[model samples]
Target: MKNKSIQIQEKHHKDLQKLSESLGQSYGKLVEKMILYFKRTGIDPDDLKNESPSHKIQQLDKRLVSFLKVQERDILKPLRQETYEYYQNYDKTLKDAKANINKNLGLLDNNSEIRANHILKELAKQRKALITLSEHLDPANKKGLKTVFQNIFKNAN
Candidate 1:
């Protein structure tokens, strides 16, 4: 590359020289790197001349916060609302299913009680029939049959 010169203040040149020495780089190399950095970052050198580094950082922070707020408004809020609605529907469905199950269990308990009552009624009828049959038998056989029937009824109770 051909060597070129540009006019700058003596104080700025001295400052650049001091920075170059501190960074252990040649003055020309430091200038080249600064130009490359500005191009790569898409920041104008003229704008940098007017703003301090802290001011630039503060502006970037504000822009980032604004962008995040916009994202929350556009994306996160709707998703959270949708999730809440889904959970509400799911909870309602679960409650309905639980109620149905409880109703069915109540029906089963009622049915079991009815069946148990029917069985006890049939056993009572059979015991009465056996007692009448024993009275028609001979005394010796009637006594043995009476004891057996009594034992059977006792165990059933």
Candidate 2:
């Protein structure tokens, strides 16, 4: 005669298990051990790992990622790129600006007054975006986020 058993793992988060090698089994088998233990005993498997606020911090850290993404059309990216390229182009005006202001500058054709105005406008908008991003990365907000991330990425090493 033989008996059949039903395995039901409840109140478990699966990833919270901790074990070492030399247990003579793969990760799947370790998970099975957790499942078996939970099923046999009325214990929650998730009570093992550190489910710290680190998860929330990881989510919050990506908030500034979009700011970093800013494309060519992006106000900050274009402005910065245009400003850098403007001075990089070899020309008298840029050379003079570099000498006088100690910073290289680029000069567009005077004939394309409309294009010049558009470029200047875009540069201004980019400056605004940079300012906004800077403010957001201020110490106050960073401190709050740091507290949350301490669990995940603290300087332990």
Q: Each model's TM-score?
A: 0.45, 0.23
Runs in model 2 with CA error above 4 Å?
1-52, 71-73, 88-157
- Backbone collision tally, model 1: 0
Candidate 1: stretches off by over 4 Å: 1-13, 26-58, 109-157
The Cα error of candidate 1 at residue 117, in Å, is 15
Name the top TM-score candidate. 1
Q: How many backbone clashes are present in model 2?
A: 2
lDDT for model 2 comes to: 0.60
- Cα misplacement distance, residue 149 of candidate 1 (Å): 40
Write model 1 residue lDDT over 54-151, tens digit each, in one string.
Answer: 99899999999999999999999999999999999999999999999999888786779999999999989989989668756745674588778778
Candidate lDDT (C-alpha), each = 0.87, 0.60
Best by lDDT: 1
- Clash count per candidate: 0, 2
